[model samples]
Target: MCTYESSSCQTGETVVIGENNPVGSGNKGKRFCPQLVGTSESFFIPVNIPSSFSLVARNIPTDQTKIRSFDCILRINEAEAGVQSTFFNESYILCESKEYMYADDLLQNNVSVSVQWNGQHYIDDPTDTYVTLYKCSVNGGSCSRCLSPEATPSFLNCGWCGTECNVIESDVCQSNRFVNQNETNLCSAPAITDVRLSHNYFF
Candidate 1:
């Protein structure tokens, strides 16, 4: 009497793919240690910056990849801005149009930005202009923008353009209202001394 034990009895059945080739050799391959990372932070390095240099802020659309063209008037130590405006010769943003950069590194040192945000350039006017002063380390790595002491920071201005008046006849820049963010102020441009770069975290 042939008796099949339920604990260890099974008819050997070969599971096979009915489609494809009837018979063939098989080989496999793969890769290991795949590397991945994301590094984006703007940097401003000062090695041998031209005494006079100019760059466009290249505002990118916050919602999409569109570019905004605006002039950045930069100056150093209460100096004239246009004097250095001619030296500008580079594109800061990746997008040809106003497209928001993924990270600050996209704009940092890659773009030539004067450290100082001196308000002498724009004629001071509380009602018409808004000024926003940004502080940065000499190394051009760390930066603090908008001098909001409590509700309102110091030295920095916004919502009202910028400083509404200049030093009477300082002649640092043309008499103008600070409407555009690309507009530059008399800042210790390009080659600023150790003392020139403000490390102040607050006003």
Candidate 2:
């Protein structure tokens, strides 16, 4: 039961599935499940979940035998959630769509529910297993900028200029050229380090 905190989630936590399948030598058949330990802030769940919230399960291979089968059940508080089984591979459980919720009350009270794998497994690995979890973006859809702090978190307005507004304009360079509107014979160029105009005008 390891707990952590990220920039977006305060209750980011992880649990090792090795306790269930502790038969193999080394990290052959182990799974890891990451879940939000607390509900201090709004966290993200995989958009791959079937409903606005549903339990998804995937059997990822962790050993050579690939005899990995478990009666894994997901619970949120006290209510049993619908567990949808997808695919199982030799490397690990591929229950990409099946996820376990923490509790039913938590899901009902909150817009989103934090999930965790708290069920017993048939095969217990000698070591530990890790389950992969994908976080959602600020929009609760995709994970475009969920992991990166420097990336733009939400949609940004580009204004009428569009992509041009995203670019930073360099200093203007003065050139000795003729102007159509003004007879000053001075022109301004883009991205010039120095100015060499004979006359300068303030506009």
Against the unseen true structure, what C-alpha lDDT does each candidate score? Answer: 0.24, 0.29
TM-score of each: 0.15, 0.23
Angstrom error of the Cα, residue 75, model 2: value is: 2.0
The parts of candidate 1 lying over 4 Å away from their true place are 1-40, 50-69, 80-203
Model 2 stretches astray by more than 4 angstroms:
1-43, 46-72, 82-84, 96-203
Candidate 2 lands at a TM-score of: 0.23
Candidate 2, 1-203: lDDT as tens digits: 23222233233222333555554343222344422223223323432233222223333323334223323333334564434234333332333345433322221122322222333333333222222223222221212222122342222211111111110111110121112211212222225689787686888
Worst 10 residues of 1 by lDDT: 28-37
